[model samples]
Target chain A: MNTTTKAEKTEKFAEHLDQANIQGRGVSPLTKLDPNLTVREAYQVQLLTIQKQLEAGQKIVGKKIGLTSVAMQNLLGVDQPDYGHLLNGMVIENGEEISFHKVLQPKVEAEIAFVLKKDLAGPRVTEMDVLQATDYVLPALEIVDSRIADWNIKLQDTIADNASSGLYVLGGKPLSIDKLDLAQVGMVLYKNGEIMNTGVGAAALGHPATCVAWLANKLFEYGITLKAGEVILSGALSAAISGEPGDHFQARFAHLGEVNVRFSNKVDQ
Target chain B: MSTVNYQSTAEFLHRAETEKKDVFRITADYPDMTIDDAYKIQEKLVAIKLGQGHRVIGPKMGLTSQAKMKQMNVEEPIYGYIFDYMVVPEGGALSMQELIHPKVEAEIAFVLGKDIEGPGMTGAQVLAATEYVVPALEIIDSRYENFKFTLPDVIADNASSSRVVIGNRVTDPAGLELDLVGVTLSINGEIKDFGAGAAVVGHPANSIAMLANMLARKGEKLKAGDVILSGAVTGAVMLSVGDTVSAKLDGLGEVSFKVIE
Candidate 1:
């Protein structure tokens, strides 16, 4: 019989998400699976899933923040945000074709991926601290996939499912942080060669740096420090764009150049 | 910035475009018409044209030169699309009957080697990905009366885009003094106007980079194999029936087309 203990419940949810990801599919919403789950409990499940990936030999290349944009915050009806770990396997090469079977109902979002030059710990991380610790920023196209079926996820459900992250493609151009007004940078997302979405840096929690500062502070509560050279995806600049097999996506940022990616028509052989 | 409904205005613009006739500027009717409204109309007009089996070849810039911008009393340049049907073959004839009052502008076109997007798109990126720089000519024909319209009106008219004649000479832009490249406009074997490449938004490549950035704001980006009309090097010269129009660039050679009555 399945026990209702906190540890058992967290383990079960973690195993469920891990299996769903391994099978390239999604399951019922975690909140639906266990209506009593709390935000803190959800974070425990997330950490457990990360542990599983780490055990499978995938290194933690970076971290990601979700629901930072007001548009996204409104979409999920949440006033707060979530975080997740990004495994090395989740890094997609720029302009590479992504296998159809590797994702489950994926939606792409444009972002500014920050590469840190110094360790950043929370408790008092400010925007200035984030700027000073950053090496540079790269244009990024992040594929956010939901393990919660139909994307029917509450904040807790997504938090437990690793913030719905799947894969990310980073652009080649590395723009210096000091050269930009993060709040004024604009972005456009193309799907299958057609324009589909547009946004500005201010869309991501008023500024991309603000999100980075928030991430550092949030992680401090859990005793984690963002290490030097680690990539931090600062959340979506625009709304998530859903696409299908054979569709090509390009996210171009003003002065940031462009990043290209394609979803292949065939599943992995 | 007014997101006021523009479906009906778009339909009217579509009808005017199909008939190849002049209509009052959209701002003539709605004096408060904004650039956003013009872009909405352009978007709707493109949709209508696409539905009619006409394909968009690529994007083109307008008023890219500071001189033209000042002459037109505008602060910034505008852009429009080049429909596949607008591409006039080399040595082909541009029909006067098919278009309204058409004027030809000498231009340098960039053929992109890779897809480029914007926000932070730079001139360096534009130059790096440019596969070829070819001399070209644009035959701009506005649906607005006497070819006179406000900025918003011209944008709604697809930046007064009509036809284009691309030259055969494809030269690598590297090592060439692009800003110093001299271009001359000849009408019926006589020089009409002349300017250097710098006249095109300080540099012809800058125009393309600007176009990429401008389009990026609307969720669009230039892709590989797309030919971009950078902008005019000199003033747009009025065309006449049976007239031979040619533009020669220093290193890129010449592109010429005949106008038929």
Candidate 2:
């Protein structure tokens, strides 16, 4: 139902996001620009921006799946989940202080990080394949930032904006996937020493590996393959917590150690 | 002047490091040890390493970032000595057998053009004395098991200082925005971490200034040509044999090395 051509919308959204990144200013949601944009068109828009980053010398490290939980899906008014490209520039180490100026409307969430030892490709990738390919599983913190102004985003808007992915932190000790049952693992998130939220691995699409399998099979439609030695961040285990400067956030996973991140007051120019 | 046995403690740490063995935290034996006593032990340890024909190449600042300070529940930065034996040349190989529980951190190394001695050195003064800045990767191997230690325990263990790899590209500090410089650390050709120079106490040069002041309290000084590692920009990444780690600094070049068994 959109009046504009797909190419035109892709170019427009790409330029808008590029400018937003460069100027440290968030723009209106993509859905606002074209209310009739289809999910397929939205993914094209996402690809356009990712292509621009690739051209700028940033490499693709892995991918992230979003809105995997029923709560998140309901919040976005979407029936299914979406995937996004994770670039090399989006990774932060555990206990690192992130600058406040680099992101717009940032939030933090606890998740599981899967480090793959074997390549997985296909329309038929299964949870078993994900388990077989996984080299280790570790605790991670995903700092989600919306390029859409004030986080005013719709399903298509976020899908077009790389599923609101920003940065991630992998820390604590990694363990072989065969050691423990991941679905029952409990997560407790603390902000400045106070309990902020709590969740379990089941919240991430019943099992974290299932989410990765979903991502692998989803990308196969576009002929993309999940490479070996790549790191994949499973969807958030709980609702996102708002980020603020000078805040200390820590996530503890049962059996898997803990990961922490802090926000600094410094503003990058 | 103090009752604490500094020489034996220093010798113990030196032997433990050279032997690549994990030991009990010093605090377990010396619960009443003061910070001053710990610093004396550190100095004695440095003297022993220097006596063994290893040159004192520079000094390293630790816990300079607010996040690390908060995580460790401490206040200010700490300083440690780096020896010539700890310098792993760019693109060199680090042996896992030589270290116990080693982890790598991305940082910025500032080489001074002139001596800086300070009771009150400012960040601007530190920058003025800096000759050039380059990307650096620090390999920290705590002699204590599981890396759990108190301030005295860590200080007496040379602040967990082990190895450092400096980048190839060098840029002058003049007119360069040292605070906003970005860094990306990759393992096996994939980025595993990213941060900015601002993480080092709001600015990299601030760590240098703090180092100058901290040294001055002990009547010491940072000499010209000293390579100062301005603390880690991110948390340490555990290293494994056969893994190649690389750190790329925006505007500065990259530093890389491989771990071998």
Candidate 3:
């Protein structure tokens, strides 16, 4: 789809989302009326719609990396997975109250977010490319959800499903990527003030930037470019820790500060 | 400022494996090691073990999912090592405490009759390089207590090396799209999860290519007759003792095991 048409569709779709209050009607399954559109095709169309919306006024904040875990690979039935962009408006700061109603179905993940110092542009992006481009890295939390109910999705289903991504929050200190030993960095996930799980940077393909490289290189095939000042959610330290309303989630980093998320009983308006 | 002599390190690790010394302790400071340096040590250790008698049965793939990356706060997938002796049979029981911090994942194992490596290898190349595919249960257990580890610790530990169980073999991808492969994983007879191979970078074979190119970047190539795990077909499921789990793939086969106290 052309970027221009995509922008228009994105605006229309966003309006539909806003009008539905992003919570009330939920999303209806697309079928029958679009005979030529497969689930995958419909998703691509949706992405264009969403992409256009973001391009209009919203600032693209970061991207979330998925399917980097062996378990998730088996669960999703894919080897390597893709990512979805996170807009500045999407991030819910640590300890900031979030409404369970604001989202459809959300899952929480602990991640290390990176802010690039320079634009990451390349047809052949490498780990070095990411390292050179990265300004700093921080511990963060990724709140993921799918427009597809129950996350019953195909590869294209998710791609068009906005990469099955949602909101995120950055925590702790943002350290230079070069100075930090990313592979050795550690993190702990706590729910409602209890330590639920712990992991390290090694969990990310040995290095978090490697995930960035994968994302950049992979997205190149899609003709997407990761710009400077853009943030990237590298990957998770461990598996996901599910949460609900009033449940508080915290991530403590070894060298970075802790990030917290508190879910509110209220739903998104 | 003394640097490690990799050859000696390899020999030392090999000796420990042959002696079956479970207490062969490595300093916890290994996380700061670079990938090149870590591989040097690993090659030596692996070579020592291979020379002494233990067989290198297969290689395990890690972090193949996006959700998993976020959960662990990681950005990329890591890797591990597997030994023939590490194979846990179908329906076998294992102790939860046996591992430092462990997780279970269902996967499709690609047993190679020929070696494969590539910076330019494609999915088709992997298929051409592969001999057979099998259902597998990979138990990812880190040696680091509480799972506090660095990249070096993991690679040295064989990427959270644990036991793996290979199910009945399926000889061909001829009828399988590799991407369309599906799996239903159940715990204690309860259907807990379901996923497909297409989720693995569009195809299970793509995972092998990822690994191959990754290895090639290190000047290493997957040797012939080496079993290379393509990657996880299903996202990992957390484990608990007394949990009996079974994963059935659409066309590949099924693998099952029990978790014990």
Q: Worst 10-residue stretch by lDDT in candidate 1 chain A?
A: A194-203
- lDDT (Cα, 0-100) at A122 in candidate 2: 84
Using DockQ, rank the candidates from best to worst: 1, 3, 2
Pick by lDDT: 1 or 2, better one:
2
Off by over 4 Å in 1: A1-4, B1-261
Per-model TM-score (chain A alone): 0.96, 0.96, 0.84
Estimate candidate 2's alpha-carbon lDDT, on a 0 to 1 scale. Answer: 0.85
TM-score of chain A of 3: 0.84
lDDT of 1 at A68: 89
Residue A110 of model 3 has an lDDT of: 84
**Clash pairs (backbone) in predicted model 1:** A253-B118, A253-B119, A253-B120, A254-B118, A254-B119, A254-B120, A255-B119, A255-B120, A255-B121, A256-B120
Worst 10 residues of 3 chain B by lDDT: B16-25
* lDDT tens digits by residue: candidate 3, A56-174: 78877767787666567777677776677787778887779887776667788888899988877657789888888888888899887767555665555565556667788888777
Q: Residue B155's C-alpha lDDT in candidate 3?
A: 58
TM values, all candidates:
0.54, 0.56, 0.48
